[model samples]
Target chain A: MAAQKNNYRILTIVSLLLLLVFIGFAENHLDLYIVRILNVCAIYAILGMSMNLINGFTGLFSLGHAGFMAVGAYTTALLTIPPAIKAQIFYLAPLIKPLDQMNLPFPVALFVGGLLAAVVGGLIAAPTLRLKGDYLAIATLGFAEIIRVVFTNTQTITNGALGLKGIPALTNLWWSFGAAAFTLVVLLSLINSSYGRALKAIREDEIAAESMGIHLAKHKTLSFVIGAFFAGIGGGLLGNLLGTIDPKMFSFTFTFNILLIIVLGGMGSFSGSIISAFIVTIANEYLRFLDESIKVGMRSVVFSALLMFVVLFYRHGLMGANEFSWERLFGNKVYQKTLGRWTKRPRKGGYAG
Target chain B: MTLDLFLQHLSNGISLGSLYALIAIGYTMVYGVLRLINFAHGDIFMMATYFAFFGIVTFRIPWFITFPLVLVLTAALGMTVEAVAYRPIREAPKISILISAIGASFFLENLTIVLFGGVPKPFPAPTLFTDVVQVGTVAIQKLTFYIPIVTVLSLLALLYLINKTKTGMAMRAVSMDQETARVMGININHTIAFTFGLGSFLAAVGGIMWGMKFPQIQPLMGVIPGLKCFIAAVIGGIGNIGGAVIGGFILGIGEIMLVAFLPNLTGYRDAFAFVLLILILLSKPTGILGEKTAEKV
Candidate 1:
């Protein structure tokens, strides 16, 4: 067991080093298109991991990620847009005072954006956490729509339907990958902690967890707020990457896309989310031909079909709450025996001949 | 606001409310029987409109023939959807069923988008329904009068079907306790399918009237109205048909009043349903007419 722990530690370091080298290589040499896809994959990884934390780990079925993302994207976008550009974009309504003049560095803006989202999450969670199951889902979905509507009507602040453009492209591969890695580390550690066990306990049986003296509301709110924070950061990254954002972009469809990712990845598995994020993103891009020739919605049809298939046949998703570990890969006796059998079979046949 | 404008808004609200009532009945009935939200209820409503569109535009059928044909087709479509997407998971976890419903909803929407091309098509509104009737200072569409009458008639018919029929008894029994209902020799599958059929039929009627009023249809048009109707159903107490109608009227009138009085907030119209829903949910989760049922541990 000690040897296995050491192996895992070494594996973690090796993977981190490999990721760093890949980022360095991609930053300097990779084509713009490839880098953009990688950036999207990283952003989706952040989104998937955050969603998994709440829906998968905490057993909360909230569908308010889009609303949180909208808040974050708008905050970051409003903060980072040049004052001159802000004036131009808010042509319909004058830019609000103080906000028009305010600007911040990318990292600070992203952090503030996430913080604001977390605040919003907490506020929403206060009233909504009392509701359970599908009621919570619908309430959160309602909140998301309310956020979008508010954003659309508050033209002075969000530029309304006109949307914001010319957001500085500050979300490079390095930033996205860095944020994704940070989210993975934080969430993994949090999940392995006693607090995570409490969350899982709550998920398994809320009544029992409460009996055991776990503060259901407090832990549920914590997981929800943290999830919302990262979702906000991911949203900020996406907005910067796309260079524009509108209220329409943060609709339930966006939430459904992220839901599809987490569901396909295995609701509670961080590694599963990461893998499925890349697969779904790349598959979406590669499937453009189907849309171009047949119809514009073929991709969505395919995705919805895949979602149905997964829900119907593979409810546990790809990882089923399990993580990939080096110990399992190299230290399992059954695997070693199988490897030995395969290697020796051919030699045994030759000797018999 | 002047009484004249208020009357105009009132008539408009009633017309919209009746449509919501029609749609909400379907949601309520399905929820009553299956204890499922049937998220695809909206998409089913949308498909009804498209079916009507195709009946008139593609098949060149008269309004008299096309309307009934669309209703039957949509009812059949709803049953098929239930059989294909929902039947297999009838005994599964509620959440799994919900996911399947959502998936089915998305499938119908995206499939429509692919087949119909994403652009909005002008609905073929018959001249009879679209004509404006002047009432002194108030001008109302002919539909404003017809819709409420149709809604009342449908409600009466549904009530009669539920109260005075063998199938209704079966449905009630199944909803109360599926295991007991099965032991009593009720065909659970058939009853559920019939319930879906009834709900879809109402949705079809609502969809046709909605198309006449809006005069435009798109693949995604049903989403908002579907959600709003579901909210109406919830507010009225999800499983109660009469409550759904009342809830629908209240929502409709309240929404129109909000827009009429606060014209600046017209953009926030869609948000109204959600806010109302959240308030109702927080304050009274069982809804106005919903009875509290204890869950068995």
Candidate 2:
């Protein structure tokens, strides 16, 4: 037990050291464009975590993650973009006129935006949570599509499809890393807590969990709402980074992209999500040049090919039943052999544990 | 509004509703047998219309020649999808298959965009389909009338196929219990592929009719209809074929009525479907004709 604790401490310290080194390298050596890509990647890591919370951990199939993100982005944009400018572009006062006058700090605005999205998510969850599997997926997808349409048509606040612009640039490496780090820490803690165990129990077997005195509905709703909250914050960060916000940006395509990320990462694995989020973010950014060089749709063709190939062959994603750890690297061979056997065990009946 | 306007709206609603019902049949059939939501189903429908468009305009084929060919090809394509994309994953988790379905959908959609630019193509409506039918209060187009007629005929044909045939019996048996059906020596794979083919054929017919009615075709056009049909299938009870038709009609008519009667809520048309979905899922998730079963862990 003492040796295991020592291994964990060493692993955490090494990861922290690597994170600092990478951040410092990005800050000092890389150009602004590279830094921006890193920022987007960090934001996606947050979004992936949000999706993982409900989809990976709780076993809920939700295609409405983009809708929640839109709620966050629009909320942040409307609240922070000056009222006079909003009035001129939007041609109408928002339903919440009071929000227009208040321009809080970026972090506070983002938090509130995430909170509002959580509320909307809660409202959606109230009824839809009763659904399971594909029904839940379809319903959530509809809700996301509805949210997109609402944002597009509600010209009074969202500026319709024309998009919202001229928001204060609030995103930086610090905020991105901070939010991602905070999410990882909080979520890891929660998963280790009793609440997370109940969630896992529900995910594994809703009926069995119910019989075990776990309130299935309550846990599912909580996971969903909390996921939406972080998704909102991620959206806020994305909006600020992009320096423009449009309803079209939050369409089914966005949802699909994030879905691809979670699948490419091992769903339910935080470190996996974080790693793949960066990998995918960079791949997408760099691959834009491929599209420009060949044709506009070439990138999508490649992406689709990769997605299909992954689905067919690498069902477990890039991590593939393995979590990043120090035990495999420096531990004794017997330890390695036992760990290999344990990880090799089939992950049946539920998601990865 | 004048009586003429009201009648026009009603006719329009029915026309759209019938098209929705046609596509909803496909969703209901596949869901009934496999309990799999084929996300790529819409892409197949989209591809069929594109096939029809190119077959007529580019190949300079007669409508009579192209229509049947398009149906056959589309059905075959759907069967191929099941074979290539879905069959191997039959025993996998439903969610994995769903993601695979979605991946196939995206792949096909991107391929369409690559092949045909994102610009909407004007589908050459056959002259017979373009002729107007002048009712007393409303002047409905021939295609509008044709849509409902074809949908009803297809539904009747499907009902006959499923209810009055040996293959239908096998399908129903498999849908009830795959293991038992297999034990009984039913060819589950062939039945599922055939079910998909039949469903795709119906979707192709609907797609052609939709292209005629809307007079515009695009790679992404099927997304909305696909979603709406899914909603209809859910509303009518997912696995019940007749219920899907009813649900499609209700959703189509409901959207039109909302727009015509309550113009104030016109913007909420899409959201309205979602709201209805949430309501049905909460109040009666099994749908109007669906049976309840406990989900196994």
Candidate 3:
């Protein structure tokens, strides 16, 4: 067993070193388009992981993710944009008095934006955490709509519908991948901890967990706030990478994209989310030919069809309820080709709510 | 506000409310029976309008023949959706079913975007409905007067069907307990499909009226109205038909009044419905007329 463990350890280190070498090579040699796709994949991976933490692990059907992302993106944009550029963009109405002159470094601005999103998440979770199932879904959806309306009206703070441009391009391959890696490590550890067990218990049966002496409110709140924080950071990274943003960009459709990633990845598995993120985002770009050659919006037709196929036939998705470790990772390729199932032991009836 | 203007607003509000009531009836029926939100319910309403648009504009059918054709097509579409997208996953987890429903909704929307150009098209409201008459300083479209009558008549007919018909009894039975209904030989699939068809028939009526009132149509037009109608259904109590009509009037009137009373806050008009929804949800989680259903372990 010790020898097997040592072999696994050596494999893990070798893979990590190889990944670093690839990133280094790609950063210096890759074309702008390829680099941009890579950056977006990492950001999406972060959003997917965070969303999966709440929706997949905690089993709370919250759809307020786009609202949180908007909060974070707007905050980060306002803080990082120079005052002169802010003046140029807010031609209709000058930015609010407080935000006009204030600017911070990219890292600090990102953190502050994530912090604000976390605070907003906490406030939203307090009232909404009591509801369950479809009711909870509708209520959270309502909250997101309310937030969007408020942002559209609050012209001074958000620049209203005019949006902000000329945001500095501070997020690169390093920043996005680093954040994604950080999210993976944190969420992976959390899922393995006792706290994660409590979350799983709550997800499986809230009343049962409450009976087992788990504090439902506290744990739920923690998970929501953390998820919002990372989602905010992911939003901030996306904004910087794109260099322009508006309220319309953070609509429910944006949340739907992240939801798609988690669902495709097997909502319960972070490893799956990370892998699926790359596949879906890359597939989306490559499938542009279907749109360009045949008709506009055909790509989405393919995706929605694929999503339905997965939900109906492969309800467990790519990884089912299992996670990726060294043994599973090495075994996955041969096993996937040789067998239909991902694991030797098929655990039936476990689903990501 | 002048009394004439008040009367004008009242007529407009009621017209809008009745349309909301019609769509909400469809939403409530599906939600009440399957315990699914029918996220595609709104998309189905969107398709009904497109069907009518094609019937009248593309095929150049006369209004009288086209309207009934649209209703039948819409009902058939709803049933097809239930059979293809929903039936296979009937045994899946609730969340998965919900996901499938959302997927179905997006598929319809994007498919429409591809098939029909994204540009808005004039809805071609018939001159008969668009005609206006002045009554004591208040000018109202003839269709405005026709809306409430249709809603009331539909409501009565629906109540009679639910109370008197065998199919309605089967619907209520399946909703009450699917397992028991199956054992009782209710033919659950046919009954559910029939419920979808009936609900979608109502959505077609609502969508046609909405096109008349709004005077223009686009691919994404049903999104906001669909959400508002769903909210109306929730407020009225999900399963109660009467409650849906009441909730519709409340929302439609409430929205107009907020804009009228507070002109400065006119920009926040859309937010009003959602705020009302959250308040209603928090105060009465079972909804205004919904029964408290105990969660099964």
Candidate 4:
């Protein structure tokens, strides 16, 4: 058992080293388009995983992700852009106060964005946590729309609909993929912890969870704050990567894209979300070439069709709740192919929690 | 605001409000029975305009023939969507059903995008609906008068149907308790399908009027209206039809009043419905007319 554990550890380190080396090589040698697409995949993984933590693991069904991302994107964009660039972008209504003068490092800006989003998430989550299911969904959606409306109207702060321009190209593959990896490790550990058990308990039956002294509000708030934090990180990466962002970018459709990822990947599966985020983003680009090849927005036609198919027929999706662990790959196992269930023996020395 | 300006906005608000009410009645009927938000409803309404557009513009059918044809076709389309997107997931978790509705809505939107392209097409309003009329001091489109009349008539007809007819009783019975309804020998499938068809018929009326009022049609135009009408219905109480009309009028008038009083906030017009939605959610999960529902463990 000790030897197997050591092997898993060694294998993990070696694979991570290989991944870093590959990223370094790709950054230097691959086509810029490929590298950019790769960065998008990583950012999407971060967004998808965060959404899954709330909507899937915690069973919150919150649709306010795009709002949180907007907060993060606008915040990070403001902080990271140079003072001169900020002045130029906010020509319609100059950057408010210290924002015009103060500029921060990319990493710091990303953290601040995440912090602000987490604060907003906590605030929104408190009043909304009392609601459940569809009502909760609508309330969160309302908040997201309100954030968008305010962002659009507050031209001085968000630069309004004109959007920020000349944003520094600070998001490299390293920052994006690194953030994705960090999100994965943290979220994975959270899911396996005692609090995670409590969250899953709340999801299964809220009343029963309350009866078991799970302190539903505390666990719910914790998940919401954490989810918003990582989503903020993802948005910051996206903003810097694209070098421009408007309030329009963070519409409900943006949330829908991540929703598709989690649904296709299997909502409760962290690794599955990461995997499907790559698959769906890559597949969508390629699928855009179908038939007309020139018309925009045609890709979503087939994409939504596939989504409907999954929702109707293969509801648990690609991985269901089963995670991708090396133990399962190495264990002598019979494939229980009755359908979407993947039962497995459990073992763990849970994460940092 | 001057009295003339206030009266002008009021007339416009009443027209828009009635349009919203016209659509919300259908939305509430389906919600009352199925308890699903029918996210695709707005899309279905959008499709109605296109049907009328093609009938009048593309094929050059006369207004009377095209209008009735559009209603029938829209009702059929709604029933088809219910069968395709909803029927299979009838027994699934609430989230799945909601997801399915969203997917169906997206499919319809994207499908329209692919088939019709995303450009906004000018709706061909018949002279009867769009012609100008002088209401004392205000110049009002004939549609302004027709809309409220249609809304009130539809509401009265719907209330009469639900309260006075056998099918209406079946709908109420089914909504109250599906198992008992089934045991009582109600054909659950047919009744649900009929409700979808009827609700969709009303939405078609709103869509046609909306096309005349706005004078343009696009693939994605249904999204905002769909959400707002749903919000309006929620404010009126989801299960109550009469409440939906009141909610619609409130939303419509309130929106006009907001812009009239605060001209700078016009950009935030779309956000107005969502703001109202949040306030209602906070103050009353059950709207004025909504009955209290206990959570069953």
For candidate 2, write residues A66-167 as lDDT tens digits: 999999998887777776766555645453567657677788889998999899899989888888899999999988988899888877667788888877
After TM-score superposition, the amount by which residue B224's alpha carbon in candidate 4 deviates from its true location, in angstroms, is 0.7
Candidate 1 residues B1-297, lDDT tens each? 899999999988998999999999999999888888888999999999999999999999999999999999999999998998889988876767777888899999999999998899999999989999889988889998999999999999999999889999998898888899999999999999999999999999999999999999999998999999999999999989998999999999999999999998899999999999999988999899999887555
By lDDT, rank the candidates, best first: 1, 4, 3, 2
Q: Which regions in candidate 1 have their CA more than 4 angstroms from the true location?
A: A1-5, A328-353
- Stretch of 10 with least lDDT, candidate 1 chain B: B91-100
| lDDT by residue for model 3 (A175-203), tens | 89999999998988888899999999989
Q: What would the per-residue lDDT of candidate 4 be over residues B1-297, giving only the tens digit for each residue?
A: 778889999988998999898888878888888888898999999999999999999999999999999999999999999999999999998888888888999999999988888899999998888999887888889898999998888888988999999999999999888889999999999999999999999999999999999999999999999889989998999878888998899999999999999999899999999889878877897876898899888
Candidate 3, position A190, lDDT: 88
User: Model 4 off-target regions past 4 Å?
Assistant: A291-294, A330-353
Q: Give candidate 4's TM-score.
A: 0.95
Say which prediction, candidate 1 or candidate 4, comes out ahead on DockQ: 1
Judging by lDDT, tell me the better candidate of 1 and 3. Answer: 1
Query: Which is the leading candidate under DockQ?
Result: 3
* Per-candidate clashes, comma-separated: 0, 0, 0, 0
Could you tell me the C-alpha RMSD of candidate 2 in Å? 4.7
Error of 3 at A186 (Å): 1.5
